[model samples]
Target: MTENDSSAPAPDRAPALPPVADRAAFEAELDALRVREKAHTREGDAIAAARRRLPMVEVDAGLELTGPDGPVTLLDAFEGRRQLIAYYFMWHEGHDAAGQCEGCTWVTNQVRELSFLHSRDITYAVFCQGPYEESRRYREFMGWDMRWYSALPSNNELLTGRQVGSMHIVCYVRDGDRVYETYWTTLRGVEVMDYNYALMDMTVYGRQELWEDSPSGWPQTMDAPPEHPMRTNGRPIPQWSRIEAGRSDDLTPGP
Candidate 1:
């Protein structure tokens, strides 16, 4: 076929297909990978089992937080539920909602429906590391109707040895007025908060993060912001949509 023919591959770009092989051979390779995939899934199950078996630590039940209705204790966050899942949202202190932690915003946006969590006798809440007035405004700006609280006053008591401004997913069990911290995780462990990343993981591009073991010629922009998956033009990707909708992101001072 001529170089310009439809069957001919583009000259400049790398071939957009996997290594050439017969159909049967390709199936065989995929089958081999399937074996490993199954094993990986089983391993994940084992890890989860171990996590469930982890010993819990008692937390300060009397720790005070600022909620919509004013001062409340950690136990109050449970809302009479058996369990509580608190997302420790990072904040820019003086920055507007648009300048809030992009990674936090992306994950927070994933939790639109709390009925599933509520059905399991669990309550999910955002414990922002900033003032209630500014942070609650950020929550409203993002259209998040879930329970929001300012953990800034109780950060030292709630987080203990952990860094105050970092993102964390902390699980707690409420027994009457007492609260116990069952599990806490950060960084990649918080990926469970993000359904978008889970969906992206199933795609051919696979998150496009530099750390993924993608095949050669795969579309991975390595130098892009790895921490902020939905970041664009120095703002969270969703912030642009909010701005387009005429929603004001100015919750605090400055950008």
Candidate 2:
């Protein structure tokens, strides 16, 4: 109503619009996102590369393994299965089958059915690191019929590198008469096959990782620290090889 007020520009005029985002700014933001994403993808690729470099080990391919019927070879144990996944069960004798490996048996027990593996033309077996005579009874007691063979008298065949700990997944792809070690994983990769821990964590505890998705104060069994400046080695601490030859006195019955 006042003359001065009328002269002023309409108060309702929309505020000056924000400057249009620069292409560089937009692209830079996108680039940052991509960097995070690609880092993850590249990390996976790097892992696969390291596994590929694990080196191939050649065995006699002629050694005999006592199957249900009789002696067999490393190849015969495959039985024409296109793929083979073997778990190296650690045993050094004097431990008895009951104590072969509480950890290894824990995993084997979860294997629901080999029928699925059979259908896929893949053979799943376990290789014992001890003498056949010492391990066969242990296998029997565990009630596992999965194809098992002894890796005794280690020749060139690939060794289960379990110096610190032994749970591993070794994949083999057979081509004609040759067998190749394809892909192998030791850490969370093996956890993919783990059923119990995953289920229980969700129901109550939550994944025992540091950045858990649960509310504050949740119970966590594994308290591994973050990998920033403090690297988390994860489960299965490093172990000494069979060279130690545990003392017989170590086996004394608990008082």
Winning candidate number (TM-score): 1
lDDT (Cα, 0-100) at 35 in candidate 2: 92
Candidate 2 per-residue lDDT, tens place, 122-211, comes to: 998876666665566655544567777765554224554444235567777677767777666664456656687668653545554566
* Shift of residue 107 alpha carbon in model 1, Å: 0.8
- Residue 147, candidate 2: C-alpha displacement in angstroms: 1.3
- The number of the candidate with the highest lDDT is 1
Q: Which residue pairs in candidate 2 have backbone atoms (N, alpha carbon, C) closer than 3 angstroms, thus clashing?
A: 163-239, 164-238, 164-239, 201-206
State the C-alpha lDDT per candidate: 0.83, 0.58
Per-prediction TM-score to the true structure, in the order listed:
0.88, 0.56
Position 205, candidate 1: lDDT: 73
